[model samples]
Target: MKKPSRIVNFLYRLVGMSYVHESVSEVREALAEHSVGTVAERWARIHAQGAEKLQHPLDFQPGLIDLHDEMHDMWRYLVALRNQASRGMSAHLADELEEAADFMGEVLHHVGLAAEATIPDASLDRGPGSTWINIPAPPAL
Candidate 1:
């Protein structure tokens, strides 16, 4: 019955489960500098990678975070993978994005199942934990 917090909503968008208006011009903007041929090639390659890639089974245990700093590693690895793909520096994502998205989805899913649990389970922190560092929000364009 409760709505997702702002932080959870941000995660949703990050994993491509939600839509935002700002990125609507993404392809057009990309084409501004690169030619149609280059864009086409990259798009095909990305889709190919998505299909051909075999993501290893995620090691997410339970609850919000793991002791191995999996959340931070997932974020860092995903950004590096995306950056590499974006720059055309590397097509292999190492399945990091899928892993990160799965990790985040596990977090959200854990918080979500709280309501369905037979016993009370309110101990979960639905957002960033106390040990998690704070990063200032980026300046609005």
Candidate 2:
């Protein structure tokens, strides 16, 4: 298997360090505890912090710009959720949060694939039926 690119490896590490999984778990726990008031607050805080922390690194690559923008969108969604929660928990709020999470997950999936893409190396191939050939280097004067 081809090794992941440096960007991909870095992003994976950042994702791990960002406590995304823990935040998700916390949201679930909040739901179980009927603490919907804090759910949006916590979600917004986590994603906003992640976006800020990653902004500089992500800005260094053009290919990463879209992912960075998507992270901002996630923060916006969380803010919307917070607004919805302020009116009291509703099934609609739950559905919206779930949908937002799913979208963010999809974005992360694409980021992983983009980062893991193998760069083509022309030297690795020879024409059909070609035998190995070595060229000697010239001696330095």
Against the true structure, whose TM-score is highest?
A: 2
Put down candidate 2 lDDT per residue, 61-129, tens digits, no spaces: 334545656775775777677567657677777677767767776776666555333223335645454
**TM-score of each model, paired residue for residue:** 0.24, 0.29
Per-residue lDDT of 9-105 in model 1, one digit per residue for the tens?
Answer: 7999898875333553764654564656776778767655543432321212222233235655655666666666656555555455656656765
Candidate 2 local distance difference test against the native: 0.56
Of candidate 1, the 10-residue stretch with the lowest lDDT total is 55-64
Clashing residue pair totals per candidate (backbone < 3 A)? 0, 0
Inter-residue clash pairs, candidate 2:
none
Candidate 2 stretches with Cα past 4 Å from truth are: 1-61, 65-87, 121-141
